[model samples]
Target: MAYHRRYSRPGTNRTPTCDKISEILGSADKLAGEYSFGGRADTLPPTPGLFVNGVGMILLPLVSEHAKKLIAKCRQSRDRPNMDMGKSWLQSDQVEMKNPSWQAGMEKLMKNIARGTGYMDIHFTACLTN
Candidate 1:
């Protein structure tokens, strides 16, 4: 008989927490590289211990902690239904047409068009036709 280990249930949906942690760590590594000696080969220290301590001890753990907190927050939000805001403009497929700023801009544009052309209504109708 063989023994196997299973961390999660067969049908449970598990979030890729390790992947998120890896991604955060990867980004921190990239930033460390960029800021350290401008990623130059000659400027790098002779000992690998410097990078190991600076990145492994400091950056990786910091980023991992932040990632875990963010993941927890996301899970919490996902577990609850959003009840704050009204329907998004994308969901409703509608926008406010009576905004004061929009009306003012339209009026200014109409004045400019009317000044350029002799008639405002005719030019506006022609623009709509086009």
Candidate 2:
């Protein structure tokens, strides 16, 4: 007579329990909301599994929205220092400091310096120049 085992193979029962499924769905929804607003409250509802991977789904849309807001804020902060420096440069009659190309170049140079790969000749020129 052949023996029948009560336990099945690992792949035979790949489905998760209903409670586990609910927990996973909840966690995903929470992460989506937190990512959307930089750790803010989540307002979106739990996504149905069938439509979860569709266009404008949980991850992409939320991340995109968050990125847009963060980028805008960064731009504003970046411009503020330039504006202040521009005013000072104007007072000193050195209007070149207000040039857009110069500012862009300076920003790039500063980023390079931050990465420790910038030119040594480019010394720190100001106390507060972003």
Question: By TM-score, how accurate is candidate 2?
Answer: 0.19
- Clashing residue pairs in candidate 2 (N, C-alpha, C atoms within 3 angstroms): none
The digit string of per-residue lDDT tens for model 2 on 1-130 reads 2122233456676345644655655555333322221222222223322112112222334577644443343323433565743332111121123224544555544544533432335554322232
RMSD of each: 28.7, 23.9
Query: Least lDDT summed over 10 consecutive residues: which range in candidate 1?
Result: 86-95
Using all chains and alpha carbons, the TM-scores for the candidates as numbered come to 0.20, 0.19
